[model samples]
Target: MLTIGEFAQLTHLSVRTLRRYHDAGLLEPARVDQASGYRYYSAEQIPAAQVIHRLRELDVPLPDVQRILQTPDPGTRAGLVADHLQRLEDQLERTRAAVTSLQRLLRPEPATLDVELRAVPATTVAAVEATVELDDVLAWYSGAMAELDALVGTPGPPGGLYDNELFTTGRGRVLVHRPVTAPPRTGRVHPVTLPAVELAVTTHVGDHDTIDVTYGELGSWVVEHTLAVAGPVRETYLVGPRDDPDPTAWRTEIGWPVFRLAPG
Candidate 1:
């Protein structure tokens, strides 16, 4: 038998912490004194306490640590831990995105702008497009991209197509598009030709969530440069949130069809 203090010494956990764990039903003492109301632990309980300590050190929540301790099978324990590690990785990625967004907003210099006009050739593409509510755009895009990749079975880079109404109307019509040499089908799965057109384009770096500001800025620039808006805007996602998972490294190109403004 080990006294509470001795158990604490063996586990290298403080007495108060042990008592709290006991109160929380996490680590219970082996026996308690009837008259004196003192707690005592068996030598065998030391290992359990040590395990709990290690888990807490890893920043596992108390509830999760309890689950881990209660889980008997080694495979089950491994799976639980793996799930937690993946969650941590996702959290780290979100934190990095937040940091990048903050830095871009706080930067001192005016971001130097680049604008180009190019005529692209008409091409057939394998595309999955939908009209999605603004709030559900991200979720819808992920599913569409997954479906496109599954059908195309291409591990190479994928591209995107964005219709202008999504921004102007607050209801977005977007496409997760991948260029394919062959023809496409429609109404769920199909190939469509993206007709060749002249585009006025500008590149923006950062997460798409905040990239709209850049889009607006560029729209204003096109007007200032005496470019006439001819057709809807198209955003080609060059590098996505999935590629780097760091928003700072994400890049998107915003292009709008334009014709020269007749001398006004």
Candidate 2:
């Protein structure tokens, strides 16, 4: 047995922390003096103390730490820790995305936005579609894309058609598709006929995190050029995550159906 101070020295934890842990029922000492009220811990408790300390360092909640200590199964304890770690990773990625977007927005002289007018012919493709809320679009698209990939393989670079109402009014139809010789109809997947239209097209390079900024730039260009938007926005993923792991190499074409308001 070792005194509280001695155990703290061994574990590199403070005496006050040990007392608090005892009060919280997280790490009770092995024994306590009846008269003078001194806490004592055994060498066997050292490993448990070290584990609690490590968990605390990861910002694990006190209740979770207590649960981990109480649980005897190593796998269960590992799973609890893994779940928290994954949440932290997701939050970190969001933070990184926000920082990247802000950095671009804050640049003194941003790159010029270049656009083109093209007449794209109507075509049919295999697609998975949904009536999704604006806030839920990303999550919905992820699941939809996975389904399309499983059904169609990589027949061609994928594309998505997003309804204007989805952005303007918060809920609308969304379609994720791939061009295939023989479009399959399975589950939510089906063949879609995309009508040809005059598109004011611009390519956005890199992650979709900053794609909205590109959208704003394109909208500004359309207004400046005196054109009226006619239909849902179209996105053609020419070089995407499926083709290259490097986000910088990903190229997406943003197309807006528009007609000239003032003849040139």
Candidate 3:
């Protein structure tokens, strides 16, 4: 038998925690001195204390810990632990993404506010489009891109055309677009013919998660360059998501159609 203080030393759990566990009906002592109100534990309780300490290390919720402690079937107990581990992994991934996003936003890099004038050629491709709320855009785009790729049977550069009117109106129009060598002739994948036009473009080097700042900088550059905005802004995904081991390595090109300025 071990006194509360001795048990605390042996388990490395503080005396206060042992009392709390007893009060919570989690770990009861082997015997209690009724007159002195002293608690004692048998030598066998150490293993249970060790298990509790490990579960707590995982940051498992107390209610979950209680349920796990009471669960009898070995398979069921293992499943519960696996589920908690999966949740932790998912949370870790989100935290990593947030950290990377913050790092990019805080990095002091020279702003590439250069304005380049280029004549874009007319092209045709198979495309699928959706009018979606901003929050659901990524998932919707992924599904549409998958369908478009299946129909085209050829992988090519990914791009999207955004109509500004939708954003100001709380809705956005997006297309899962890819350039094709010929006219479209497949199911639900319609041929998209882009007319030749002048464009002002800037390349953004980072994850699309927070590329809005780059877009804002580029748009300002176009206005300052005296280019007259003509049509929807196009985002050409130069590096697809799966191509990079780290999402932060992806690159995107922001192109906005414009009319050339007359000589000053």
lDDT against the true structure, each candidate: 0.79, 0.92, 0.81
Candidate 3 residue lDDT tens string, 117-185: 788898787888778887787888888788777777646778888888656775778766888776475
Q: Where does model 2 exceed 4 Å of error?
A: 1-25, 29-47
User: CA shift at 4, candidate 2, in angstroms?
Assistant: 8.0
What does candidate 2 score on TM?
Answer: 0.78
| TM-score for candidate 3, residues paired by index | 0.67
lDDT of 1 by residue, 61-120 (tens): 998988988899999999988888888888887787677667766788758678889887
List TM-score per model, in order: 0.67, 0.78, 0.67
How many angstroms is residue 203 displaced in model 3 relative to the true structure, after the best TM-score fit?
Answer: 2.5
Identify the candidate with maximal lDDT: 2
Model 1 scores what on Cα lDDT? 0.79
Q: What is every candidate's alpha-carbon RMSD to the true fold? A: 4.9, 3.6, 4.7
